[model samples]
Target chain A: MTAVRPFRPRSGFHADQRAGRLFAAYLVSLLLHGLLLFALAGGWPGHAARSDKPPVYYVDLVHKPVLDPQAGRPEPRTPDTPVPAPPEKAPVRAAVPAGPAAAGSTDRRVAAALEKLRDERALQEKFAAMRQAQAVPKETPVGLSDARGTEAGVGTLAYVQAAIQQNWALSPYLLADPRKAAGVEAWVRVTYSRNGRLERFSFEMESKDAQFNESIKRALVKSQQLPQPLPERLEEVRVVFNLKAMKDLAGLR
Target chain B: MELITNAGLVVKLVLLILAYFSVTSWAIIIYKTLVIQRATRDSARFLDFFWARRRFDVIAQGLDDFRHSPLAVLFRDVHQELLQNRRAADGGGEGLDADLGEQDRVARVLRRATTSETHRLEKYLAFLATTGSAAPFIGLFGTVWGIMDAFHGIGKSGSASLAVVAPGISEALVATAIGLVAAIPAVIAYNHFVNKVNVLIGEMDNFCQEMLNVVQRLPRSRQER
Candidate 1:
């Protein structure tokens, strides 16, 4: 039988043949890409971003926000004073109508309000007494303890300001083509844990735009925990997010 | 526009690669289209000429004309195998036995030749495949990087307005657009060329079968070394 060797085909010369053309294609590719980039960049030249009336006061700060909770009111506002409660065992209590007076609706309403005021006063006094009882015996006076923890720690004021300023981002909502509110204000009470992380913070601040308020809140959250360790026995802390500081940083004079 | 121009270095480099791929893919498209068209036509004409002849010797004289054709290469390989075996056996009783057994061995040689031709037809097709599959993800990575930079810019500027955000995002999108542009044609061309190559290879396989039949029909007395 004939010994048939396996047929082996020679390699095609086309790839080698097209070497110059392929290189040329590469050049053309680069040129085309450059043109695309140029077109994307230069297309619609003079495309101006029309802006709206600038915001009024860039930002405002209500040191405590009376509701946001208000501006540095050292004393909590008191409701109108309630009439003094009658003695607990006084015989006069039996003579008084229970609430629904048989004579008139106005009389009944007044009696009911007076009774309610008495109950609230007694409750407040009981709470005060309970608080006094719970207080540990210490060298510092009770009145001075609350007054001692100021709204902000004197030592960390600059550090806190810098950290908040660095973390806070101004969104388009605050600075858009046509701006919305002239300015926004917020009050934040940040209480820190021993580990320097936020323990609890009262952050619900009111603004014309909810989104604007949220952005500021987010900035506070994004601080990755504050830079300094909290002072032992210090708790009360408050910060005012004023747009004025941010605008200054942005050089928007 | 400024966003893209001022995009991070990595982003710019990604865009550059996408551009290169786009250019090379299109180049391949143009080149392959012309080459395949010529190859198909040559194959058809060569097939006609091959079948027109009754004798193998007469068919070989015109091989140069179809040298570029894949089918022509197949024929040359089988022909060479035939010549080798024929020369190995001198004209005697051994030549007779060799001729009887030659056809089957010749068929095997034809199969191998056809495979080689198919390999030639499919050259450079893998590049098209890789570009088609990977470019979109590459562009996506670039876009993701760009968005990260945009957010970083926002953090730096302390402005979250779209006025500040729009440019960076738009610049990032350019990468994705270019990547798609580069990949689309490559995918299409790859599918088309693969189909065409398959068709051409099928024709070669059929030609092998037909050649075997033709050789089988020829008289053993005429099968000389």
Candidate 2:
């Protein structure tokens, strides 16, 4: 090989610069990695995308429509023919004394007008009774706990009823009480926490029979913890317990 | 932090491995960036110096400043080969035949130098490729192990509620996120550096051919003459 010639001292300088740069870059990279780990360890509060709100559950308490479809249907109109004068016309006659032919005709017209007004009032009363019949059935004595919260559905209400009924102890002797059996009904209001703990309770409407009311109180006490936790929004329920209705619900004679 | 701190031991191990991969690969990316950029800049400037100066001795003396340039290395190697051939021809009193042989020897030297320069440019790039390909799977391994632990927890607790399972799953998923974090930059840097190296290789090859032509025309080394 030809003798190697020594060049100016630029190579060492270049190599030294490169080494310095590489070292600096390594340090920067280490600092960046440290920052990343620090940020991760800090948890970056509120940056999490997950929602914290509890899922809301909706329950349909009343499966059937509250208003009857037939109640809203227009009533059939009666023909406008003049109504015949019946014994009820005595009041109209008493108002009109003996008069000339023209005066008598006007009095007859007045009596007819009064008769039409009475018929219209009777029709309105009949419609009112029909509407009332179509309204929601009143509290059943079988203790279908009324869940007033919007979130409580038919299933939840049924669950509450079943849980309470499972712990209820209705004595056969109380049902056999001849004088008070039919009249033994009590309304109890119960409130619960999210964890199924019974928070508070009171007798909203108590029965006159002390024994029957005591039995209702005992059932509530026994069912202190519901089988399932109450829905978040459902906290209070009003339960009506009637001895006769309970007997009927249980298929007991 | 709780997500990582509360993670299972296996997942934490995986995260640690990924962190290693990420930090090292980033360092490699930085070092390579500086190296490739210097090589490219110096190579272009060396080409300018080579064309401007006609004397081989001047070019050889200037090679030190362009030491990072692959073209400069190729020129230096071929120039040394030409010098050796010139000495052999002058000492042996063989001119015509030795000149032809000298061209062949110089060509061989050019090829070897091109190969060496390419190797230098491509150094340290394999680690980036390895990090890109392996990190994600390693992270996935951690995630699978975490989920297994979570299910095991459920079996022991006898509870399958979201509250019981969610925290475990969240912690497990963190491994996957970290794996992706480690892999993405490595993959990007690997691709970028590969392209840069390829461009340098092409320049070196072209310079090798150009240097061979110049050596052929010289017929003999100027220093020997």
Candidate 3:
């Protein structure tokens, strides 16, 4: 009788041989697929290379303002007046005078001499009154309180006063009613660049009309420099344009 | 005619194609991730139920319930072979003493079953690997085509300014981005599924050997009865 052999399970079959084959197949397929993808997409490296360069951009320059070195001093001509050219032949015209013109001119000269004497008297009286006022020391006037000994402070104050006087003055031709503009008061805020060019201009308060705003904008644009060079640390120029004082002077209702 | 006849059109078409691939790849990635997750959970639950019963007859009877499971399919094949061998021995008047022949038959059945299940688990996984490995290259092709067209357009348009070059290049680049979107998830899923299937196959192989050991140890009366 043959003895039954003890059941010996083969470990070879138990080993993951199939798994290895599957893994190998998987890897091979992965490689082939990778190759196919590369062929289709042009590969990862090429895509990365393209991403490295950024697109270029172009922009246009606009709104540049020219600056003149000297500006902001009082202009000689008022809006109401026109500048007259010098007479080319004054001497010849003066010598050839008509008989009625000569007689009238003599009479006008006599009257002008009398008027000049009266003006001198009035000027003498005004000088005397100023001396008396100086002799009696009193409280400093409110208007003079802001007066500064520094050259820059004085210059800036003078510029502000002059600008206010020139633009805010009442004339029948300047406004619908000369008295109406007197009530308009505004603060001008000015910004300048390092090279003394006006960079920005604005009003702290609204102007009486769009025309006033436009005029201020034009004034700053036209003035290449402030009335005086700003102090080294200060680049912004600010001043109040007071129309209320003009209204008072004109006696507006 | 010159305005319309530029490389820009080609670049746009390539970009559109890449965009389609990229959007689809991302969708596949999300879908496959969910599928693999659910498969893993189901497989684990089935394995737990199979082992907890501790009786081969109960597991064999219930295998049909687990027919959708890859592991269950492997087990069913082995069980069928055991039943067939038992029936054959009964016909031969061996009275169930044909233990050696039965063992041989069972091993053969298991080996064949293992191969089939492995094949089933690995199905569709190849597509993932292909996408992962190839998507970037596909995108690059589109970009290259676009760049070539851009140069051609430049040759005809007589200008190399930014306006002429940027739009074309931008459109071309969309393809490469799409390729990457498709490839990354596929590569990840391929790796993940491979690992999971390998582990299940190992478990199945181990279980087959255990069943063989149990069958070999049965008493003669029990085997015949």
Candidate 4:
């Protein structure tokens, strides 16, 4: 409680400065926010429309190795003793590579060189059959590049594969990831009568990818029935889903 | 598709709230800056004008320019009190301006004026403090909620991949980022405005004492013409 206090004066500028400054700042912030929104909407990276990249799928046909059934017990070498053997006489490969060696591998690099030649003489005989078959109404088999090269067990395989290829539709979800899609390997064994009426079907090989696996199943189901009548000798057809052929059918890549 | 539309409802709501906080906080900052700046400038001018001339009539006549300054309000109140006290004292012809009680009364009047002016300067500062401290936490809550929803989506979708969860997480994080955006400036402005208010309050207090000192030396009563 001091007795008397001295008297002085001060400026009044701070009295209500907050209100005006706050109003202005609020306005400025809103304006700036609006401008930012406009900029974002206008695609500020030079105003180009932000078009989504269509996921490109480079479909590669992976040919599973055709295991030599003549494996484990090597046939007695016909006196062509193994050493750095002459390239002209390399053993057991270029034979009836399926017997017909149908598509004489138009692009050698794309053809996985798993073919072993027994002798050029045998290759000449199969090549003649392959050329004759190609001259007929040609049908490309789905799983393996050329089914005519096989012995006599692929007419129904060819028909079923063509049917599934025609029916398989790639889902857009699967289209987002082609790498994942390619790994989806599933096999369906269809039991059919000689008249080609499908009696039953079950997955023989199920790849873990559910969506891609489902697409393969859906394709077979969509086909419903094969195009041509099956031979009486063929009671069932086990078809390995060729995703590459499916991609070709779906026109995805 | 725009990422925001894909964001879960909780995240969207949180973003909306953060946006509101940002807009409001900016408003406060802008308003506070303008007010404090004007107050400082005009109040300083008023104080300088006051000290140079040391005249009630001259400065009081020009209180309009310093309307936002706490000091002006202080000066006006004190000046009015002093004039009233002086008029009362003149009729009594007591101990003049040197009278201890009269001096004490003027000091009391000044103390009161300073208290009220200081009060005025402190207005809206609590709002600033609240925004500065709470906004970030509010934003964090939104982020947490958004992440929770995102994880829930993954659980429902049965996909634990990054692509599945990334968009949701990004959307949720936006709330936290915006919260910080709103809070940072609010905190800066609040501290600054508080400091300015304190300086203005100090000036008003100094002014009260100076006003008393000047009045103490004045003649107790006007002589007969």
Best by TM-score: 2
| Candidates' C-alpha lDDT | 0.68, 0.72, 0.56, 0.66
> How would the candidate models be sorted by TM-score, starting from the highest?
2, 4, 1, 3
For model 3, residues A111-157, the per-residue Cα lDDT tens digits are 77668767766776676555544443353211223332322123333
Better of 3 and 4 by TM-score: 4
lDDT of 1 by residue, B61-117 (tens): 787777668777777766775666656665332433355578877787787777767
**Error at B188, model 3, angstroms:** 2.0
lDDT of 4 at A145: 39
Tell me the TM-score of each prediction against the true structure: 0.50, 0.53, 0.45, 0.50
| Candidate 3 chain A: 10-residue stretch with minimal lDDT | A60-69
Most lDDT-accurate candidate: 2
Q: Which ten residues in a row have the lowest lDDT in candidate 3 chain B?
A: B1-10
lDDT by residue (tens digit), candidate 2, A89-111:
33444454556767878877887
Error of 2 at A235 (Å): 22
Query: What is the iRMS for every candidate structure?
Result: 5.3, 5.9, 11.8, 7.7
Model 2, residue A188: displacement in angstroms?
A: 34
Model 2 is docked with a DockQ of: 0.12
DockQ of every candidate: 0.15, 0.12, 0.04, 0.22
Q: How far is B214's C-alpha from truth in model 2 (Å)?
A: 0.9
**Which stretches in model 2 have alpha-carbon errors above 4 Å?**
A1-21, A43-253, B90-100, B221-225
